[model samples]
Target chain A: MNDMARLQKQRLALYGWMLVAPALALMSLFAFYPAIATLWHSLFTRGTTRRPSVFAGIENYNDLFADPTFWIVVWNNLIYAGITIPVSIIFALAMALWANAHIPARSFVRSAYFTPTILPMIAAANLWLFFYTPDLGVIDQITGFFGASPTNWLGQPETALASVIMVTIWKEAGFFMIFYLAALQTIPPDLREAARIEGAGRWTYTRRVLLPLLMPTTIFVFVNAMINSVKLIDHLFILTKGGPNNASKLILYWIWEMAFAYFDSPHAAAMTILVLLTLGLVAVIQFRLVEKRTHYR
Target chain B: MNTALASRPAKRALPDFDKVLDALGAWVLAIVWISPLLFATWAALQPSGTALGLDFSNPLTFENFTYVWNAVPWAGYFANTVVLVTLILAGQLVLCTLAGFAFARFEFRGRDTIFILVLLQLFILPEVLIVENYAIVSKLGLFDTALGIGLPYMASAFGIFLLRQAFKSVPVELEEAARIEGCSWMGVLWKVYVPAAKPVYLAYALVSIATHWNNFLWPLIVTNSPDTRPLTVGLSLFGAPETGVDISVISAATIMTVAPLLIAFLIFQRQFIQAFLRAGIR
Candidate 1:
């Protein structure tokens, strides 16, 4: 290029670096550096007094594979994510549709649908803890009026994860609903009117036209819901703490326990590396979809 | 034509069954969805004994609130949360805004690559790095401080991404005009770009405040003592199994911890929802 062009480019480069320096520095310190550090740390065993720090070289990964608890937690997390993601998405869409439709007390309905998103998961857990409490709990009291037996919802291993799943759905659906609501609002009224003119039933129009239009939103919500299932296990701290033999334990929550409770830093690091890999893969897929969707615009 | 016009009036006057059912369904779901919060309110306002029964006719009292308020060092927790959220928000705004402006405006080598790397943080959240982050925090002697709690979140990928989009949308003429006025890089940003992105800043601030205000896992891991513990952590401790699950008192504590955002949401429900709507559009 010309000398003037070269100098302008150089100036741009310098100014760009100067502007982004603070953000880059902080990200390196916290995210990028720690990510590499976690992977590096995962390659070694924790040191004790007698044995100085030495390389274990994938021994932690081997242990993680062999460890039954790790496998159990992995399965539990898959189950958690499997159930919560789809159910929450469906509930979100339903609630959004209902909220957006010509209904009585439209604002109140929308508020009710969206209110749960604001409340802290810990607080929600605390509230649900009361609901899941034995015969004294509201669920049991209502069930008892119909001659049903009272069940210990949170105590039993079989029901514990499911109970937590219920809370996850409750907490996540409203947040996802907002996105669907936004998507719904963007759909032209004329399309619905035209569909009616074409003698399309509600079911046919929704299935053929509306849902196709909402595909981008559905993918976005699904990806977010998946990521949420990975990261959003805060309610577990109050609700279950991976209780009843690790039935409700998610991968992230398991890592926390390994690192802090057991003080097994290396194993936790290995787990962290695994989670990062999974997240990385998921991110790649999400970006591909987002790229297509945004580019399509 | 006369028959058709008469039929239109008759149909309009008739009660629409489907519409009535839809409204009923909406009300039922709304009631069911909000029943947990309703239950918590019921439990908090009544005596613990009657709360279990779902009794609403009993004498209502603020005894649980008073008990919860006096029982915990809630003021300390609230102070920590306010300080932490403010710090994180300030840090995010400054860092994200500058970085966003750079990506949006400047033509530089490896710009796209660096921006993509920054966006990689969208998926590799700080929460996932807690194991190493804890070590990093303690190494920096920032353990149990609000800074430690807020540090990792300050460089938010979401914020940077949102602000970059906002900055890109601001007409280039404004920036050029500011520069023509002999404004420095920061001056152009201040005089033109930042002012133009005000609505975006407000929307982002809402998301940041709500997210940080309810943020649990990181602060929970980083902060050990009550001195630096945010409301979520404090409330978790109060509701732990060992704390004796006095439902009424725990409900009271939960309400107090979440009250500020909840109250704000109840008042500015439109803005709150709109902010989330805006943020989610990405």
Candidate 2:
């Protein structure tokens, strides 16, 4: 009887371990292992062949700090994130308000706004590349219609980076609008009615009630949008290759170039470490904001 | 008496004004929202020679579609993408469920610490670690394989966090009742926990598929050869500098690549919007 009881206990313990085993194992290998290995790679120098590598201490990181291109990439990323986040958030809120209003064909308008969100970033980039073409694209034709000279949207150093940022905002705004819409739904209907009964103006109600209520959603959007801006590189590759003299060079794009184009694995790893550190800082800010907001709520 | 009555009327009058303003604003916004997409669809139909032409006289043609298909291996890409997305989803569902349950129910030591560490992974994205990840994949002999491409995302922190939240909401009494009835832990999970979390599972599935379907950089790096390359990466090769691609052909290719998801979104927009809202609740 005791032996049977021991057997049952063993089986239950086995079952419990099995339940958590797959998750722990997969995460350890894929997520945790790669992250640790990346840190290791940063400390190593590449040998003659790609396969062989040796420990090289802080040299890779040293090269990163001294490189002018590294600074340029960092500057570009900051400018891109700074411009895109606020613009996208404002646009998203405006769109959500428009959609949430008693509009004719509201459903159609909502889907139309979100159409770009469903499209792949690469595909959208390609489509926009067509429009940005100087000689044969649609944007040039539109300019010509207005009797203006055709602009080399992607070809020029000055316009290329701005063009990329614009496309990103256009793609992201409507998607963020959905979050705003959800937040809008959660607002009690009686509040809006009571505001109306109290003789509150539209702008007054929006400022006093809606904006404050939307604060959490706005913060959430800001964090995700910032993360996206830092990580976005697909469009850069097809759009300009960080060029018209590397005007559009972002940190991640530069890391890709370092690893694949330059075949400098150590330098790429070092740059990646920097990107990770930046992300960590952003995350800290996000957590503090979230905690403070929760307290306010 | 007249002045006091007039003021109350003004209060009622203000809502009427707001309504009119909202209605007008909605129509104006709708037109602006729809125009760019309508223009893109219009342009997609035009031939290369006349696509950029300002004239509206040239009729729409299917030649661009023909050109796109013949120019790229889109069929092969479509097949590879299906395999990749499906494999990733299957792996994630199982892994996330287990981890989520563990975090939600188990009284294991250091649980919060380990879970917090997992959540920290959200900040350290795979893109930033792509260089070393590639090295790791090559070492494991998973390069040029769908499993390799999907491996990085299989244990998603978002999924774990989301499912954990949902699992926690299931009543403890229900779990206890199942235990009293001589139900095994696995039976309770399958019978009670999963059933209760069905809506969350659906929402997570859609989000996962949408994300992985549109994923570009990692798959581009891991899968080099055409046999393994997904649609986005495959389409890149078609438009490489070595091969001069016309604007119309590229647009056609773009449409082909994005059409499936767009069509699905249109068909199930209600569900899509609902799922998206659920995700936002996070």
Candidate 3:
């Protein structure tokens, strides 16, 4: 009887392991393993003569720290995130409120707003490329209505980064609005009615009621938006290629150029570590911010 | 009395100006959002010479699309993308459902820890480790295959996390009764847990399909040949520096590449909205 009980327990253990083994193995190989490998690769260098990788004791990282383009890319990433997240979130919040309000054709309006979110960024960027053309774009045509000369929207360094930022906002705001809309629906109407009974004006009610209800959703949207701004801005490859003297150069685009374009895999790997650390710091800060808010909510 | 009055605001109590402004605001926003699609449609239907001229009155024609269709092997691109997305979805559904069931129903030790680890993986997406992943693909000799493109994303942390939450909401008594009736574990899972979680599955499917279909970076990195390239990468070939293709043909190709997904989305607009809502909440 003792032997049979032990066998049964062992069998269950084996079954559990069997069920989870495939998932764990894949996650480790694909996600966790690469993360650790990138960290390791950052510390080494390919020897100058043979291109054989040798332990360089963080010299690659030192080179990365000293590079001017690296700093420019860093600043560009910061500016990109700073501009994109807040503007997109605010716009999304307003859109969500407007859609959630008792407006006519709300469904049609919501679908139209949400359409851009699903379109492939590459395809949308192509569409925007046409829109940004100096002579052919609609924007140029509209500007011509006021007797202004055609301006090179994407070709000029001054407007290149902002142009990319604008497209990013257009692509993301509607999607973020969906989150705000969901959160808005969960805020019971009774609470708003109670505020109304107390003579709270629309501004007062929004400041005192809706905004507080939306704090958690706002944090989620913010962090997700930040992640996107950092990780998924690949449309630069087609639209600008970080061109016009690297004015639109972003960190991921830089990494792509280093790896494939310049054939500097080791340097690319090192820069990835910097990118990873930046993302990690931001994620940690976001986690801390959200954790504090959870106690009060 | 005040509560009643507030709950049912009198029709004449508020100024009608507020509602009128709201309507105007929504209409203006919708038109702005739809203008890009409108513009793209305009560009894609016109001839190459007149396309860049923005001659809206030149009248619509099917010539640009047919030109693009013959210029590229779009049929191959569409087939590859469909196969890739379907395989990824089918894999995710089975894997996520099983893992979610295990975490939600089983009393096994270390389950909570493992589930938290899975959630953590969501933040550490594979994109961050692209260099090492590329090496892994090359070493496995799966480079340039749809299977390679789909393999890394097959087991999604988000899907598992979501489906587990869904499964936990299933009543325990339902499972117990099935057990008492001599039903096997798998049978109970299929009979009770799955049926109860249909909506969650549909929501997950929609999100997964949209994501995989629109994925550009990974596919761009993996696929080096035209035979295996998806639409986004195929569109790039037309825009290559060497091609010198006209903008009208490029727009035509872009429309052809994205139209299937767009049309499907238009038809199932409500489902897409609801799925996004459900995903956001989860």
True contacts kept of each: 0.83, 0.51, 0.51
Place model 2 in a CAPRI quality band.
acceptable
Residue A72 displacement (Å), model 1? 1.3
How does chain B of model 2 score on TM-score? 0.89
Count of backbone clashes, every candidate in sequence: 0, 0, 0
Q: Per-residue CA lDDT of candidate 1, range A1-297, in tens?
A: 699998988988899999898998989999999999998999998988998779989999999999999899999999999999999999999888888877769899989988889888899898898789989898898899999999988888999999999998988899999998888888877786677678777789889988889989999999999999898899899888898788888999999999999999999999999998998899889889989988877
User: In candidate 3, what are the lDDT values of residues A1-297, reduced to their tens digit?
Assistant: 999987877776566666666777778888888888888887787645756778877888889889999999888889999999999999899899888887779898888889988888888788787778887688888888888999888889899999899889888999999999988887877887777678787789999899988998898899889998887666786788887888999988888788777867778889888777777787688879978887876
Write one digit per residue (lDDT tens) for candidate 1, span B180-243. 8899988989988899999889889999999999999999899989899999999999988556
Which ten-residue region of model 1 chain B has the weakest summed lDDT? Answer: B1-10
State in Å the error of residue B160, model 3. 1.3
The candidate that wins on TM-score is 1
Compared with the true structure, all predictions reach lDDT values of 0.88, 0.82, 0.83
What lDDT does candidate 1 reach at residue B119? 81
lDDT of 2 at A202: 68
Question: Residue A134: error of model 1 in Å?
Answer: 0.7
Worst 10 residues of 2 chain A by lDDT: A11-20
Candidate 2 structure quality by residue, lDDT tens digits, A23-114: 76766776677777778888998778556777889989998889888888888889999999999999899889878876567788788777
Could you estimate the TM-score for every candidate? 0.96, 0.92, 0.94
- Residue A139 displacement in candidate 3 (angstroms): 1.4
